[model samples]
Target: MTATGTGTTSTLHADAVRTLTDWRPADQDQEQLRLDYLAHLAEQPEGVYRSCLPAHLTASAAVIDPAAGRVLLTLHPKVGMWLQMGGHCEPGDADLASAALREAVEESGIPDLTLLRENGAPVPAKLDRHQVRCTGKDRPENTHLDVQYIALAPAGAQALISEESLDLRWFDFDRLPELTDHSVRDLVARARRLTA
Candidate 1:
């Protein structure tokens, strides 16, 4: 499907728009957010793929261990907060789910993390809208419309800190770090239901 937005003509982005437009969110709030994202993408071609604008699409994973008792988190260097591992979508990404999985694997250094999906597309466990500082000076401040998913880590999957992270650790659901944000907990709750 060709996109009717104002941005570069990329079929990859058209696919992303189509995927988001077709997804069924779990609740009314999510439904609204999904529709908003779809509309934004339909109007702004770069809206679905750009990381430098005021509002952009991002994908993240709440990395759940195989036993589902612990979640892997990364201390964001720029934000100075403990958060889930995720980042902006890239051109090579086939879809948003693949983008989320790619970010999870890259940041976790875990080779075999498994993403949850429905009907062959990555199904987000939850959606979050939050403001983020542009980590790079070239990009302006932006709002991240994040597609959050639950990724199952292989047993004994060890997390290593990448250049983007100050630390990486697994926390029990009941005892996340003191610096972890409230949204992390919400992501966990949604993820638990998905994994259960």
Candidate 2:
């Protein structure tokens, strides 16, 4: 596996391109989004970073505790929604999966999380495109082209809330809070299937 958050912007950019190129989409919509992400990276070489405009690539992960039959979610302060842990591709992020794992660790405060892999590789389980004021409330809304992954956390793991989140909690697979949107629900379902 590629080391997380240990490369330069140029290297991270290249890895992003290669990752999207090699990723297999589960459906036509995801395929199109994959193509669109590739196009964005081509046009804007720095699209993997948060500084990119209009749209940028972001990495996220759903933290699943299969033994406990639950998933960890954060109540985002900015979006005011219960969602997975993720953010911009930082300079230290060696690859998309590493970035996702880093975000998962930081957001969930779980030190021993491992990514759910396919064919022994940490690949994305889903892709989502959404608009957000990621920069700040004063800044214009930008599109987040998110690459989502599933991470496995140790059972009975204790979590600590970070500044980015309003609250953090675990929810049963079938009993997610109403604050979560369809996208999050979809991610949870996908994570569940991956673990099961």
Candidate 3:
């Protein structure tokens, strides 16, 4: 849970953090742009320049159980909402898939997870738009070009549930609780279709 010099701050285990930090996608264009923009913002001092910069950036991973018709989800602490396991992409990570896998293993405690990709090839995932709750004087806007992937777990896989989550379980598609986040529901549906 110690903070790495790379700016990732989380209470998850050190191995989890290291695994995610080491992830790298096959393509380098988008990764390069993110690094360049982040560097630009970092070099500017706190002033008018910093005020105009974007405040939120992140990535996520979806873990689906095809045979059981279920998906693993965590009830997040910050929003008290159920969500897929993921977080901000760290510097030096190669791509989103690695990040997603790392997050999945950390949050779910499922070590034998495999990422679902198209034709056994790495295709770039589409951008996903999301919103964050207003924090009093700070109405922070959040958007992420999530590299969505379908990941499969063996039946009866148990989740180790991290401190970041209030609860963790595999919920059947038809038995999913009423989720407050629409994107989460959409992701579940998409994952089901892809795996089926």
Candidate 4:
């Protein structure tokens, strides 16, 4: 498994190129996004690391408890939606999966989460490209090329709301919030299937 947030991009392009080469996106849209991310990486070199520009790479996680009966979600402060835990990539992240796991642990406050794997490789189930709200002077509105992963949360794992989130809660797989968007629902379904 890739170590947690220990590999920084050698020249701003190395990390993104390396991680994308290893990732296997699950659908057509995802495949196209991967190519777009690669193009972005090639063009900007720093695209994989920045979050405040026109387009930047981001990582996120869909966390499921052991039985897959529940999913951990956060009321995102910027989006105001009960969504999966994730955010911009950090320089310390070893790979995309590591970045997702790091965000999961931080946002969900679950200390013992692990990435869901198949055939001994990290399983990246989906990709999301969405517009982000401009919430800070340095964080102007932009699109995030979000790499999504599924993670397993140990039984009885507790959640703590970080300053970035308004609240944190676990929703039964069958009962998500009204405002949870369609893409997130798809992510939940995919996570359930992949982790099952």
Sorted on lDDT, best first, the list reads 2, 1, 4, 3
Tens digits of per-residue lDDT, candidate 3, 96-179, equal 466667778888899999887666643323224455542323666543434455667887788888887899988997777775
Instruction: Give the top-scoring candidate (lDDT).
Output: 2
TM-score (all chains, Cα) for each model: 0.88, 0.93, 0.66, 0.87
User: Relative to the unseen true structure, what is the C-alpha lDDT of residue 28 in candidate 4, on a scale of 0 to 100?
Assistant: 82
Q: Is candidate 1 or candidate 2 better by TM-score?
A: 2
Output the TM-score of candidate 3: 0.66
Score candidate 1 by TM-score against the native. 0.88
Among these predictions, the greatest TM-score belongs to 2
Cα lDDT for residue 174, candidate 4: 89
Candidate 1 lDDT over 20-106, as tens digits, reads 777787689889988888777777767756553788888899898847488999999888888998998887776777889999999
Q: Is candidate 1 or candidate 3 better by TM-score?
A: 1
Candidate 2, residue 156: lDDT: 92
Worst 10 residues of 4 by lDDT: 1-10
* Poorly placed runs, candidate 1 (over 4 Å): 1-8, 135-140
Per-residue lDDT value at 105 in model 1:
94
* Residue pairs in candidate 2 whose N, alpha carbon or C atoms collide under 3 angstroms: 5-92, 5-93, 5-94, 6-92
Ranking by TM-score: 2, 1, 4, 3
